[model samples]
Target: MPLFEDLPRDIQLAAMENAARTTLANRYGITPGAFTLQQYEDNCVYRIETDTGPHTVRMSVRDGRPPHHQASELAWLDSLARAHTVTAPRPLTTTDGTFITETIVEGLGPSTVAIFEWVPGHAEPPFREPGIAEGMGTVTAQLHHHAQTTALPDNFARPTWDAADILDRGYALTHPDHPLLGANGAAVLRAVAERIHARGPIPERDRGLIHGDLHRENMLLTPNGSIAVIDFDDCGLGAYTLDIATVLSSIHRLCRNDSEAYADFAHRFLTAYEKIRPLPESMDRFEDFLLLRDAFIVNFVTSSTNTEVATWGPRRVAGLIAQMQAHLAGDTYPGTLTS
Candidate 1:
């Protein structure tokens, strides 16, 4: 009986799988035939096999959001599904008709678990691929459109992802201070955050529910040529441009070696997004949001307690800081086009 963190990798996974199975049987009444761990870093994500089909079960060990936040995510997903907008993963309730289950793992303490009917699709091609970036744009706009017209339920709750939340008060940079970033890197991050704050308030019309982590990996390409968005764990109230910047910054990092390809991808994405909804106002400050996206990643990586993930934190934070420094110096942020 070792503490969860002290257990060997395989042993920890076995314990998690067992916990998932037990939870599924007791809560959902679906005894799974197979269970596979899909992600092990920030959260424990599993692919469970059932007679009907596959479904995904997520175990949130450190989730601190209120119950309303989880409810808010499922509500939006249901709305998008019914609206026939972009395909969103539909959540399943427990046998008790509750959306969330409070449970404890053998080694770990309390955790929040939920299940989603497995989204039917595969990962999309690289952003450099033609039409791929455009598809991301179209799907993002579809979500924004739904958010704009729909009325939020009175009980709905979510975080507001603004410059201060993501950057100025980032978990890694400020929570006892990240060792790798030190003082200078922290200053660089604060400088960018200040510029974003100085841009003034976001228009009422420009703020809405957004997929705060809508990068390439969160998207899937279905058989019928539709883009399916997954992982609503980070959904929140934010400026629409923040979502756009998330997508653009992902492409920029992936295509860092090829400026031409990055430009092509950015052009295609923005052009297609405008076709759906007018680009969020104040896009001149779009690059600022892009830097914010990088800061978000830095916080995510450095805050992880997982040893494997923490091992990569330094290098990852370093790379992200380099990009931020370039933006701070007024040099063209990579993959950003002035035209």
Candidate 2:
């Protein structure tokens, strides 16, 4: 079955109209002609040409599960725009001003659709330049600062980061017969969970609204040398340190080959961030945060029963489990930024 055919008809229509309005007749003064869909590792993005130029429309899928927090996600985006924090895709509204249109497709479950003005740019490749690192750091700091003040909706689900939450999910992923399950996975997960629990909850001073996922891929570099951050789907209220950890982990993943170059980049990024929002006094726990981040990814990837996940999840989970064991056993963790 074709991917989109599973989306409800109304949602499909809304998506098409959103593509038309945002890219063409609304501000660009031209109509869109033919549209083509680009499937990424995570979402289905469509590119259409308008009289003004070409624009892209993104639609997120749940893989096999139901839509995850569609209403709350849109609400958070609206709140961010209202607060005037940073430039985010304002939900393209209909004549009636509703953010999403729902529809029921035959084979697929209910789906909600929304649109936004496409921001154009390319992802900075790994180890490009130290200047890029500074740019990323400055923007991330600004984003965290803005997020700190925004009031999120009541139902905004926080990122699953609590020690118990991590352990519970970790066990679920490592259940016997699961391909990703390993002898050391459960033990490593327990150790991390216990360490976090013993440290106690993060004090309110270190907790705030954060872009739970702030990797380089989520940022776009425009022709004018400006950077635009996109994809607030993972935005939530969490430890500010976790946000920093996410960025650091992503940099390490992308620049694994050129440690010296990425180390320079990481230093520049962190320096810029410290200038804006200084790292918490508890920043000494950053190594723990990094371990938590890696373990969380391992659990998520392994728990997913989706075929797309099965191919790579097991191996990656095993690798992370081994690394965590080594760390716990006094081996220095490998990465650009060490404790």
Candidate 3:
């Protein structure tokens, strides 16, 4: 039999869910009904149903992200909600008025748990819609503007998404010697990492709190037609271009069949973004940003405990290597910046 971490992701999630059932009543003072597991990646997200309305409970399954980090994420979300910068899911406090509740899961160790008010919107809508890219750009710009002007709590802390952290460190986390990444694939990754480092430090204006994972799935289309960004689980400090690269890479993957649409999507996003704030001059080297994002994806897939992700790791790594090799050859990959 496989170990807990090696077990199928659904089994692991079910075990964790069973252990966490008491949390809803004891921490958030709600009688849980139909608590369905929504996501089981670095964290476990449960879509909890109640008489009043649905809520979201996120449990950090790893030890690397401490309670303060979770609190800091909530702090930024709260700031965005208060400033009306964007429609972000707001965190709900426990019965004791605290942001996070600590609990021990069966296989996973001590975990940080937080409940959030359900964000209203359609999930995973088509990104190629006429206005979808524009909405993403607008909401992203709004969030960045708020981050630049507003002051986060002094204790606010999240992982930095710099070159070393984003590329080299992530690759290392995925295990440099992993069989999926043969000598050629490993060399391509190293070359991309070197290019990222050679780009030098980010200019002060370009560096700030960024939603580290603002891909298409993370942006929700609200009923009023506004874009609502969710899943702040990866929000952190980094160059604002990181967020741009995230969405653009997603567009590249999703729109691979139509380069024309990809170009239009990139154009619409940047145009709408500039309407609020000028893009960072560093965007001249946007390929590095895209490659950086690709590297992160490789690490995420390779290191995931989820059996589904594990199964996809080899193919995903191969695609990422091809993209990296394309860049190294001075040619454009599907995700290379079009506009």
Candidate 4:
């Protein structure tokens, strides 16, 4: 596990060469220059400057995560861009029009890489800015609205937000005598399972294409206060309300110290979104959705190698378990799902 910065120059060159060939950069005089790595849990994103400006080359090590996945993702993104749903990174194609290049890193496993035209903007902290909620809400509504009519390819895997899936994932966290498994973990798993059972099965009619992950960190902001959404890696067919639930859960986490601000942000987001898409009568199920969303985060952080979560997982899990207990004990938050 060599850190991106620690990789020898030769390996970096190989990655750069692979990117150039795949993106058809030879045709546009685009040669890789200095590179910086932005590594996430499942992939490594290299920001490579070329003759044509900056482009991103994303490499995923886990099998089934690249080449085909990249191609499918770019197709969906291209559709969204054409429909003006939101600003997404445009995939750069080679002279042959292929979307990915296969490459091998010395210490890391084999990877599939793709080049994307860089999207310029900065990410603003949503909890710190009240106005951002409206923009986010509006963008989310528009995204869902557009996805409804967009034709998906045969291989597109729709996201599953079913309660059964959530519970099964949580249960998988404790396995084969892993040291992290304990009474505390067991309790959390049980709580999540009980919540899922109480919620019943996810309604079949509510399924649609959703961004899957809509936290504030995934949005970019321009100087004029306009926003652009990115990272459709999790985009798939699922409960549309689950997207709203993800945003609300993120708001809760962001505004933990300022309850009033959290309420304000939630209000603004819902207000703007409803003006466009108008929540369904079944939106009353949001509380259940919130519970499952929080559980998913808990399981993901505990199971992942993400540094931020690695440092913060224990405390966050405790807080979330407490919140779940409170909800189970009849504590209620405002905002009716029916509204």
Q: Estimate each model's TM-score.
A: 0.94, 0.79, 0.94, 0.82
CA deviation > 4 Å runs, candidate 1: none
Per-residue CA lDDT of model 3 for 222-246, tens digit only, reads 9999999999888889889989989
lDDT of residue 311 for candidate 3: 70
By TM-score, the candidates rank as 1, 3, 4, 2
Candidate 4 clashes between residue pairs 3 or more apart in a chain or in different chains: 23-94, 24-94, 158-237, 283-337, 284-337
Candidates' C-alpha lDDT:
0.82, 0.64, 0.82, 0.67
Residue pairs clashing, model 2: 8-105
What value does the lDDT take at residue 310 in candidate 2?
Answer: 64
RMSD of 4: 4.0
Per-residue lDDT value at 124 in model 4: 49
TM-score of 1: 0.94
* Model 4 lowest lDDT segment of ten: 171-180
Candidate 1 C-alpha lDDT tens digits along 1-339 = 767788888887787777888888899998998887788876789888999899999887554566668878888887887898889888888998877786777788777788888998887456766678788889999899999999998988998888788886678658636687866777888788788788887787888999999887888988777788999988999888888888877777777898787888888988989899999885877777777778888888777778778777888889888878887887876555666
Better of 2 and 3 by TM-score: 3
How displaced is residue 94 in candidate 1, in Å? 1.2
The better-scoring model by TM-score among 1 and 2 is 1
